[model samples]
Target: MDNEILLRLYSIYQKELYLYLYSLCGERQQAEDLLHETFLKALLALPGGHTNMRAWLYMVARNLFYNQRKKKSREILMGEQEYLSEKQTDKDLLEKILEEEKRRELYRAIRKLEQKKQEIILMQYFSGMSQKEIAAVLHITPENVRVLAYRAKKELKKNMEEFQKKSAGREDTK
Candidate 1:
C-alpha cells in the first residue's frame, strides 16, 4: 500500500479500531498503544493489493491484543485504584461510578455465556462489527456469525433476567 492509501485507511479506521481495542481491554492507554502498533504492523505487512481492509485491520488488532495479553498476563492488570486516584469532581465521579456499575452488570451477563457466545456478543455489539466482517475475522461463515449472534442475544437476555430476579429477591429480604 502506498503512503497515501495507508493514510486514508488509518484515518477511516482509527477511531473504530481504537474503540474496539478499548472495549476489549477497557483501558484507554493500552488501547492507544495497541492502535499504534496495529497500524505500524499493517504498514509493514501490507500486501500488493487487498480487499476487506476493515476486517483485516480488526483481525490484526485482535491478534496483537491477544499476543500482548499472553505475554504479560500477570504484569498487566487494570486496577480500580487507578480510577480512584484520578482527580474528578463529585458529579463526574458519580457519573463514572454509575456508568461503571452498568458496564459491570453487562459484562457479568456476557461472562455468564459460553466462550463462543461471549466473543460473538462482544464483536457484534460492543465493537459494532458486522456479521460479514465478524465472519471474515473469525474465519467462519456469515451464516454462522448470524446464528451465534442470535443465540448470544438470547443467552444475554436470559442472564440479565436471572440477575434482575436475584437482585429483586435480595431487595425484598432487605
Candidate 2:
C-alpha cells in the first residue's frame, strides 16, 4: 500500500483505534504514541491478505500496546467512568442514574471476564466490529469468535443477575 492509502486508512481508523488503545493502556499520551507507532508500522509493513484494513489496524494497535507494555511493565487500570447526559427533570434524573448504575455493573462484569472474552465483547459490541472482522483482528476463526461471544454474554447475564439480586437484598434491608 502506498503512503496515500495509508493516510486514508489512518484518517478513517484513527479515533476508534485511539480509543481502543486508550482502553488498553489507560493513558491518553501513551495511547496517542501507540497510535502513531501503529500507523507508522502499517505504512512501513503492509501485510499480505490485508483486505480487512480495519481489522489489520486494530491488530497492529493491540500488538504495539503489548510490545510497549512488555518494555515498561506499566498497565494502568482505568478509573470508574460515569457517562452523563444533558440536564433533566427528576424522573429523567432517576432514570439516568439507574442507567448509569447498570452501565457500571455491566462494565465491572466485563472486566471480570477472561482476556479473550473481554476482547471479543468489546470489539463486537462496543466497537461495532462484525464477527468476521473480530476474527481477523484476533487471529481466530469466526466460529471461535461467535462461540466466545456467546459464552461471554452468558457469563455477563449471570453476573448481572447475581448483582441485581444482591442489590435487591440491600434495598430490602433499607
Candidate 3:
C-alpha cells in the first residue's frame, strides 16, 4: 500500500493489534515490540499493496508471536538441567511461588481437555475468532465448530468441577 494508506491502517488497527498480541504473549512490552516488528515487516514486504490488509496484518503478528514462543520453549527445554540446579532463594520467590501455583492449577484444568477440544476453545474464546472464522481457520465446517465448542464447554465445566472437588479435599486435609 501507499504510505498514506499504511499510515491510516496503522493508526486504525494498532491498538487492536497490540491487544491481540498482548493476549498472545501475556506481556505488554513483548506485544508492543511484536506490533512494531509486524508493521515494519508489513511495510517492507507489502508496500506494493494487500487485498486483505487486516487479515494479513493479523496473520503476520500471530505467526511472529508463535515463532517467539516456540523459540523460548526450545531454549527453556535446552536449559532445563541448569534451571533444575538453580536454588530459589531470591526476593522474587514469593511472586514466583504464587505464579507457579496458579499456573499449575490452570495447566491441570487445560490438560484435562482433549487436544481438539482445547484447540477449539482457545481459538474461539482466547483468539476471539468467530465460529465461521474459526471453522475456516481449522478447515472444519461451521456446524462442526459449533458442536466442538459446545462439547468443549461441557468438558471444561466437568474439568473445573473435578478441580474444585480436589481443591476442597486438600483444604479439608489441611
Candidate 4:
C-alpha cells in the first residue's frame, strides 16, 4: 500500500487493533505495546501494493496477539509469578464476584461440549470469525466448518436440555 493509504489504515484501525489486543491481554499497557509491534511489523511487510489491506492488517494484529499470549502462557508454565493479589475495594470485590459467577456458568456450558465441538463453537462464535475465516484458520474446508458448527449447536442444545431435566428433578426432590 501507498504511504497515504497505510497512514489512513493505521488511523482507522489503530483503536480497533488495540481493543482486540486489550481483550486478549487484559491490560492496557501490554495491548498498546502489542499494537505498536503489530503496526511496525505491518510497515515492514507492506509491499508497494496489495488488495484487502484492512484484512491483512487485522490478520497481522491477531497473529501478533496470539503469539504473545502463547509466549505468556509458556512463561507462566515456567513458574513466572505473573498473578497479582490485591485487596479489592467493596465495589471492585462485588464486580469480581459477579464476574467469577458468570465465568463459572460459561465454563460449565462449555464443558458440556465435546472437544472439537467446543473449538469450533469458540472460533465461530466467541472469535467472531466467519466460516470461511475459521476454516482457513483451522485448515479445514468451509463446508466442514459449517457442519461442525451445526453439530456443536445441536450438542449444546441437547446438553442444555439435560441440565434442565436434572435441575427439575432436583426441584421435585426438594
TM-score between model 4 and native: 0.53
lDDT of 2 by residue, 3-50 (tens): 788889888999888888887777888889999999998988989576
**Considering only N, C-alpha and C atoms within 3 Å, which residue pairs clash in candidate 1?**
none
Task: By lDDT, rank the candidates, best first.
Answer: 2, 1, 3, 4
TM-score of each: 0.81, 0.85, 0.59, 0.53
lDDT of each: 0.82, 0.87, 0.70, 0.66
lDDT of 2 at 5: 86
lDDT tens digits by residue: candidate 1, 1-174: 588988999999999899777766768899999999999988899665668899999989989988988898853333242255367888888888867766677778877777667767778876788899999887899999999888888988888788788878988998
Clashes of each: 0, 0, 1, 0
Instruction: Give the clash count for model 1.
Output: 0
Candidate 2: the clashing residue pairs are: none
Q: What C-alpha lDDT does candidate 2 achieve relative to the native structure?
A: 0.87
Local lDDT at 136 for model 3: 59
Writing each residue's lDDT as its tens digit, candidate 3 over 1-174 gives: 468977998998798788767755657788899999999988788735455566677778877877898888842111011132256676567767656665666655655677556656766775676777656545678899899889878877787787779878999999
